[model samples]
Target: MKFAQPLWNDLKCQLQDGFILDTSWTNIYLPNAQILGIGKDITAHKQSKQVLNTQIEQEKLMRNIA
Candidate 1:
């Protein structure tokens, strides 16, 4: 299956440590809104992918060498 690209709407910052994530964020429409964020740590997944890619490239190089 195929899908269109996603819309990019995330703003990056350490908001809570100081404040917009520089005075403070204001959402006047939702005056009582509280924000919560969650994320996954993909270090293991990324390392495994890198190892697999390295092996694939080594095999390709060996084939060309032969």
Candidate 2:
């Protein structure tokens, strides 16, 4: 039996509603030339991180002004 190694990747997808979707995907290849993939949504996590980063930058600016 021959099998391709499994791989993982992070992808970004854009929706018609103008929302960005972050996904982590895992791909597995089978001996019969079939491939299977699984994806998990991480939009909320990414958005939260962006908010936190902005907050941190604002705090830094305020500190510099002090």
- Candidate 1 lDDT: 0.51
Q: Score residue 44 of candidate 2 by CA lDDT.
A: 90
lDDT of 1 at 40: 37
Question: What's the CA RMSD for each of the models?
Answer: 10.3, 3.6
- Among these predicted structures, which one has the highest TM-score? 2
Instruction: For candidate 1, give the lDDT of residue 33.
Output: 73
- Which portions of model 1 show Cα errors greater than 4 Å? 1-33
TM-score, every prediction: 0.47, 0.64
Stretches of model 2 off by over 4 angstroms after superposition? 1-7, 16-18, 29-35
Candidate 2 residue-wise lDDT, 1-66, digit = tens: 665555768899888998888988997766678877888898798889999999999999999999
